[model samples]
Target chain A: MSDTKRFLYVNRKAPHGTVYALESLEVVLIGAAFEQDVSLAFLDDGVFQLVKKQVTTGIGVKNFAPTYRALGDYDVKKLYVERESLAERGLTEDDLMEVTHENDDEEDVSSIEIVDRARMAQIMAAQDVVLSF
Target chain B: MKFAVVVNEGPYTHQASDTAYQFTKAALEKGHEIYRVFFYHDGVNNATRLTVPPQDERNVQKNWSELAEKNALDMVVCIAAAQRRGILDEGEAKRHGKGEGSANIAPGFRISGLGQLIEAGIQADRLVVFGD
Candidate 1:
């Protein structure tokens, strides 16, 4: 049997209200070390997790939004932000934090794929494991 | 078929745990092999032995423990989530300098790292997540 499995993490909740976003990131980071084909889907209120310029000073909780930027260091590069989710929230790609990872084959290339709902659903259906939070 | 179950909510407060329990029971009755039941986020709370429900109410923790024991199932409580929520096992409580009695893990449930979750994803034929 193949050791590498296609793993998709479906994130549908906003950060801070509950521990789902932070905990989901924790799982993703851990899963990256396992060398699986890991992909993250940010849809519904989950898109708010990647919104730039978040100030948690008033919230008094440690702002973990910056950790998403570090996912690349762990070799977790596939972050699929749903286009419809962004549109529904009146957000554009410009509103999100710049998340990029150096391509494995090419040292200089880095990118983040913004997919629509249909594409995201397709990706979800193709995964060997679908972990939703 | 091998199945993996991920519970993302705490007992009583959310119906997620109850639903997951019912689904697992049904699957087991159908002779499906349960690879593992991973408790993440608030779901870790389900593994605590300290939960005290009223006499009339169903004890969700007990129900899970009994089911796991009967089926020889692997019920894993995520270590990180458990620590954050104070669901310590005997070893964890000792290593963290918490008192021996500080560990309140229920029977048939073990504290494990997130790697187990990933492993389950790879080993199981199906992975079903239950959450609010």
Candidate 2:
């Protein structure tokens, strides 16, 4: 077992409309500030946060997608994208930003992980701290 | 172990608060120490002092207060969420020109920022969240 503390932040909501996703991200960043081993998992509508070409300025909402990239600078390098979610939404790895790590060997993306939903569940079960958004 | 729990959903309307309550209980039973309980987003409503649920139903707000007091838990309400939701402290209520009664948040809580959550993680062994 890893001696480091593992934190799982599961964001299940979309960006922009509600504060759930953003606040969750903030919590993860804070966790990193404390030197904890933090990981983020985007599930359901939460995957929208990783989508590319978001235009919130037109709606007068602050574009939160840019903040997603800041996670890397904060040392939150583990970002997981659920595979079934992508398949159901007809989205490919190319639709998201470069910061995401795709786990799917089939997808040609270089940075995101596309794990199966069951595998995602396993990851959650393994974490010492799991926060759901 | 030292711990911090962030609650992002309102207590009355959702299951998030209930789940957090249960988790805290379990963690405490296992002899873990809780550092703080931060409420944000719609969760600011969890600190309302005027909540009055039906007599037949559980009074979640009062229950939360009791839990904190009994555990000697440190509770914080996010300043941003509290302002947007009209939940305020004495200083903020005066700044907003609202009456003292309108501004005082529920007792047993403090107003704080995201940085505090980070500090909680640094100071505690774990940081857990039950979000909306």
Candidate 3:
């Protein structure tokens, strides 16, 4: 077996409309299965993947947000959200499932750290592998 | 380390391509080698040679082509996606009986199958994706 790899998974698309979100999740699971240290970052519309109270049966699609909670079981506990993305969508930590936040804004969801884009870029640069979906 | 980059979105459609490009550049700068870049789904549009965006807008096609040329990147476009989206290489155009002069395959890019992606993944240390 190969040694474990460190991976940063960045999701930048909406959850329901596009396959990117689902596919990214699949990749994350695969990476975890390979014993890789995996982290997930949701930027732009990708934050919708963590949105609580989603109802997808109307669209004939099973809501996959619940699957996100299982990521911890796979040892993928590093879930991050961009503060700006939440603000852009008029969302807050209350709107999403419990996780960690990377920023410091009360009005905004404190669930995840709100790291600035520059810091985010730096984090991405430090990663051994990055997959954007 | 070697890498297989799968780009599934077009250049101007979103930041997926730009992000992929920047990451690839960073990877190279970090003493890493890109085994291949496989463009699929909407990403096959990145290989269209006939794109001519406005001067004010960023020409993503040119950027990709330039990077590919400088690094001698192995760029592969999914043939099925290319044909379905009206992007055809010389051989494909000829086989399909299109105009004789249609050159949809951009330089530094080859239309190929998923096998190329699988091969790249097996050879590289990592398989990264910039998906739509």
Candidate 4:
């Protein structure tokens, strides 16, 4: 990557019903190839996207819930979830699917970082580019 | 300043595309550069040449094509999103075994991967998103 910029993707919608969630993820995956500094923040209903064991066969849509786990391989290891959003949806860290990536030290590290709304604001303010979905 | 625009909605049903077009046009008028306009989600629909809107109504696709023609803008429609929304280019049409004229991409818009989007973000001074 030439002159890597801090890129952040803000996902604030539900996984299904609309296509924003999938579209946002598609960008993240494609951006991963360039090895840029990327981070994903899941707030509002986007936090629901990480709920474990999502079965969408009945809705005639592919179950893409498992794809979140593969983000680590793409070097998209910063998965930030708003702590208040999770609590608002009656979810805990246990409800989220575990996603981990190997660090520069070669140690397995969890990618998901549950942060408060204040910190989420700070994170947004710190990015070179903020792509909202 | 170099700008990157992201359109996340389709044509007429939403104002996202229209607003993005106006903003992009103004930006060019103000002597700023548009690095790229990456269409995602339903926004891929804006690249279709098959639309036949009401006579009195503004044609969204035409507006974009004309603007691009005049300004030499890089309007990229996401391949994945276009495929999901039934928008196809010449290559996609042939690969999918569709009949002639199946490719509905307009003159100024090209089908490309999301890598173009990332590149735009990396290259542009500002990345503006228009969506719901």
- The whole-model C-alpha lDDT of candidate 2 against the native structure comes to 0.78
Tens-digit lDDT track for model 4 on B1-132? Answer: 999999999999999999999999999999999999999999999999999999999999999999999999999999999998899988999999987878999999999989899889988999999998
Candidate achieving the largest lDDT: 4
lDDT digits (tens) for residues A23-99 of candidate 2:
67766765675777788899898888899988987789777778787666676778889988887888878798877
**Any runs in candidate 4 off by more than 4 Å, and if so which?**
none
Worst 10 residues of 4 chain B by lDDT: B95-104
Residues B68-88, candidate 1: write the lDDT tens digits: 999999999999999999999
CA lDDT, every prediction? 0.91, 0.78, 0.77, 0.93
DockQ for each numbered candidate: 0.92, 0.45, 0.13, 0.92
Tens-digit lDDT track of model 4 for A33-98: 888899999999999988888889889987777888999988889999999999998999999989
lDDT of 1 by residue, A16-108 (tens): 888899999989988888998888899999999999988889988879999988888888888999999999999999999988888757663
**Worst 10 contiguous positions by lDDT, candidate 3 chain A:** A101-110
Summing lDDT over every window of 10 consecutive residues in candidate 1 chain A, give the lowest-scoring window. Answer: A104-113
Give the C-alpha lDDT of model 4: 0.93
lDDT of 1: 0.91
Q: Residue B37 lDDT in model 1?
A: 99
Q: Interface RMSD of the predictions, in order shown?
A: 0.7, 3.6, 5.0, 0.7
What fraction of the true Cα-Cα contacts (under 8 Å, chains A to B) does candidate 2 also have? 0.62
